[model samples]
Target: MNWSWLGPPMDVRPLFPVERGAFLDLLNTLTAEDWERATVCPGWAVRDIAGHVLHDQVRRLSADRDGHPGPAFEPGEALPGYLARTNEDFVRTARQLSPRLLVGLLDRLGQELDAMWAGRDLHAPAGLDVSWADPGAPAPTWLDVAREYTEYWVHQQQIRDAVGRPGADGPRLLRPVIDAFLRALPHTLRDAAAAPGTAVTVTVPGPAGGRWTAVRGAERWGLAPAVPDGGRAAAEVELAADTLWRLASRGIEPAVARTRARLRGDEALTGAVLDIVSIIR
Candidate 1:
């Protein structure tokens, strides 16, 4: 019921331990065979993804320190090709060392990140323009670095799933990251219209309830509270937040959402609501 703005800038110090702890816990549990299993990320086995994550941490830290804009991904390279190349490089490097050695590398990298963040002013201007492969993508800076924590957690889950291990960390660790992704959704979805003159509510069902309202207008869009008159019934559609997040991130199917979602005013509005969330990922 609380409509507070989610995913604002956070102090990195408090967040680092949680992120590092989760990473360490995950790596500690992996057997050699577990690392060889295929991950959900295409072209990446579990070990390959783990290696890439480690590589990213090192690269991002170097970029942050040297004031280099993060890696320049070539626009000509397809997403799969770029990721495959990066993953292969990481896996090859990791393969040269023992798993213990790889874990040590991650620890050293984490310590470097901790030290850099401890002394550095995150808001300070880094004198470079970093771009992602996506057109109109935001620069890869401290903000992106913070968001990477979320990616780390999610991808860690992929590793867990591949190995048949349970993800014991609760929503608390994921909340900030999820909030960050949700906070950016409106701007990303503005250009995609699911319907005109329709106000929709998206409810994420959990122990703690969270809701997002998207109203379509003639020339613009507005986001507000999905309360009072805008409960689940007043809105055109409603869904579990986890379901929406997974679908938005392309971790799940829109068709699955269509079947599972509760519809109210119009079915078209459900499609529109999905359209709004879809662009963010």
Candidate 2:
């Protein structure tokens, strides 16, 4: 189905609010037993994933208004270790509350976040970095929001898949999620020493699908609409929509996605792209 909205904002900042509503709608239809269903997140059940989603919104809301309640980590702990410990702690704590309590808290905060972004200038200098990309380097605020939207959208999909409920697969919703995840592609190949102007193309073939090229620049690789006229792509990778999401999110094994992906030209570059992940470990 064509999920296009009337002149949907291409900025992607508007996506989080819409996706949150869609997820809430799905949650409303679930039974108490449904909340206990196992999700693709391995150990996390439906309620656990929902609680994680709630944790994300709550932290985002707090960051916007007050300050982030920094994670409880021991001395000598790195961010990755700290995040894993804290997220587990958050989920465990959330499990104490009923599903209704989790849903209600998310609902109230999602709206507050929606209003906060609606008026914010996306081009303003952002203190946040897409950590995986140039760690500690400031990134565009729009990119930051795009990353958040992808996270929100994907976790919800995990819940949907567990419950046998399909969602956000239409052109409009699926496209943005794909686009946002690909933003990490350039960053993923940062260490791969490709010649300047070498390009890599990723195509997801479907009605909602589009092709994107990542061209190596003097300093880094960046995304573009297409390779320059007569420019041959250094590598090309093709994947199905569903498989693409699983691969990009690290939800599936690389060996598994390779069975479904078609790669041409530089195998190494394509491998790097396939290994790209939007979320932190």
Candidate 3:
């Protein structure tokens, strides 16, 4: 399917189909040589990343169908460690395949994921637990759906970055990914108590961007609309759209993003924002 990666990012709520199509279109354009090119992910070439994406989709789909957790990892394992090891194992298994075969798998698995999501409800409790969200607790169904789209978009962006393709910028595509990524922020700050009403506002600067304030409530921090109609933030972090997405996804270095970012207010809160990562490791 030939689709334009250009124009504004789409307003794809409960995002699917559109971004999935876009990812597939971009995947189709990768030349054999392009697939061999190195992406920002260390030790993973463009083709390996594609394999990783496909592997994740297939695994998640299978888990959903089984309606139970897959074989358990050791308890008390950190989220990033679990993801990195799991992803590495999957990528290693797919490493011997020809780029053509791997690409074909991406297409097939994408269709499977799309079909699996179609029959599912977006508002009910999702079947899986998002470890990043409350450490083994079940996240809301909408959050799970949002994370799925963000996964596809970010992986596709990695390929685009490797091959010098552009056009996933702006709010339509990024806003959802950014919002979904930020869901972990409250969890990240769950223990870092602030005064009852203190807040932290994360601002991504661009047309497809927004400001979200996470105010510390009695027991935890939670996200609210950016406009401080509620109260002033104790800390505000402003980063360009690209930088924030990259950092949140662990696609960029925290130090680097912080250097390029405009930080105001509380230092500790800003530090937590910098350390916020949606990806495992």
Highest-scoring model, TM-score: 2
| lDDT at 264, model 1 | 71
When summed lDDT is taken over every stretch of 10 residues in candidate 3, the lowest stretch is 1-10
Q: Write the per-residue lDDT of candidate 1 for residues 1-281, one digit (tens) a residue.
A: 12122223445356766777777788888887887899787777787767777887777787767666644567797655775666567678776666787778888887787777777555543333222111344433454555566566666777877888866346666555455445444454465555544566666667423665655556544465543353342355566656665665567777887777777765555565665442222
Candidate that beats the other on lDDT, 1 or 2, i.e. the better one: 2
TM per candidate comes to: 0.75, 0.91, 0.85
List per-candidate RMSD values in Å.
Answer: 4.9, 4.9, 6.3
Clashing pairs in 3: 9-172, 80-280, 170-208, 171-208
- After TM-score superposition, the amount by which residue 161's alpha carbon in candidate 2 deviates from its true location, in angstroms, is 1.2
Error of 1 at 244 (Å): 3.3
lDDT (10s digit) by residue, model 2, range 177-281: 887777777788888889888999989999767887888878778777678677889899999888888888889978898899999999889898888787777
Tens-place lDDT per residue, model 3, 1-281, is 11111112222344566676677778778787888899988999998898898778767877886565654676887656777888888899888888777767777777777777777665566756655555565555666777778888998899999999986655777778876777777776776758877778888777867776777767567665553456578888998878878988887788999899999988888888888878655
What shift in Å separates residue 183 of candidate 1 from its native position after superposition?
2.8
Go through the candidates in order and give each one's C-alpha lDDT: 0.60, 0.80, 0.74
Clashes of 3: 4
User: Ranking under TM-score, best-scoring first?
Assistant: 2, 3, 1
**Model 3 segments more than 4 A misplaced:** 1-14, 67-82, 226-230
Clashes of 2: 0
- Candidate with top lDDT is 2
